[model samples]
Target: MTETIAPTPNTLPARSIAPWLKFTLELGPLLLFFFANSRPKLFAPLVHPFLPAKLLEGESAGLFTATAVLMVAVLVALIVSYAITRRLPIMPLVTAILVVIFGGLTFYFQDPSFIKMKPTILYACFGLALLGGLVFNKPLLPVVLDNTMSLTETGWRILTLRWGVCFLFLAVLNEVIWRTMSTDHWVLFKFPGTMILIFIFTFSQVPLIMKHELRGDAAAKAPEHL
Candidate 1:
């Protein structure tokens, strides 16, 4: 009798949430972050009941308030996601961990610098992780992306490389923006700016994805031997 091998996490099909819901979960917190920072007075009352009184005062008040809101919103999003899917997606889970840690530090130290550095650290870690996977002969972009599309190994390699580079570039860009620009400007760039860039980059890769995409007959036959 032949033994059957179990599928690994990478090979398992993703339990995907609705596209709209996923978008809301991801972008909602960001928009709230911007809103809270821009209008801290609005969120202050809501969050004041939970956070330290000292963290919500003075010039950094808006930023600190936004950080608190962001931390809570991210946790809520994760909880909603897990409740719906019964499993947390890896990328969001990692992001939430970083948000809580960095946001906590920003609140505790009463400094906005930590929150400003979160994006740089998050993107850098993602970029390095993808590159590291390539070095180990493992294409990890699909894993991070939840294997939404099927592609040839070569395609995965190329796509992974592109995303890895893009992530690193975004990391550098975040550092530049936060270090040189005002907090408000940085928030603006972090939201619509980063979203626009990612959308453009993603659309630009459509041709590459189509070129290497596994299709009807090929897809059906590719795994027959297995």
Candidate 2:
């Protein structure tokens, strides 16, 4: 039998959202984006707030169906995430909530622009929240990643800053891609490609984090368990 070697000082699990689960969670938004972009009104009825219930009951069947599907998918993803993690994560939970709201708006207003602008909304929210955290001398990354890595407060600060910047970059990239590239390219990039990019970026920062590593309970538990 071959011995399997794990990554040295692997800060986190290789799988973030798991395989099939991740696909189910992320794929919904992509499909909604494409459908809405192509059909334009594919999600308008179920997306809006002030629209009468009969609005979906009367006109725009296609848009209603698409928005309904999108809502179900978002709910499923959120449920799965909460189930697995035993608590909601900051980013994905926020993503889910925004997807519902924006997706609803896209369907309700019969305007593709609202849904198209989803990335900008997400990016701006996270950017502001992170920057706010920094201003208060509080780094939120560790709270989300606390179970995964052992690092000092300064390490957390550095990591959060890098990620905050990366998220901002993603926001810009999303704008450029959606504006320039085909919808297919944007969706494909959003899924596995984004995950890979984040992994690589996070790994590159491992050394910097390790430099400020703390001997926490995860360290303390190692020998005791052994």
- Give the best candidate by TM-score: 1
Model 2 lDDT per residue over 130-191, tens place:
76788888877766553456666677778778888888887888788778875556655665
Residue-level lDDT of model 1, residues 1-226, one tens digit each, is: 9998887865564366899999999999999999999999999889998878877887778889999899999999999998777678888999899999999888777789999999999999999988999999887888787667778888888999999999999999999999998888999999889999999999999999999999988766543210
User: By summed lDDT, which 10 consecutive residues of candidate 1 come out lowest?
Assistant: 217-226
> Candidate 2 versus the native: TM-score?
0.64
TM-score of each: 0.89, 0.64
Residue 209, model 2, lDDT = 80
- Which one wins on lDDT? 1
| Candidate 2 C-alpha RMSD relative to the actual structure | 10.0
Model 2, stretches more than 4 Å misplaced? 1-68, 83-86, 216-226
Q: Candidate 1, 205: how far from true, in Å? A: 0.5
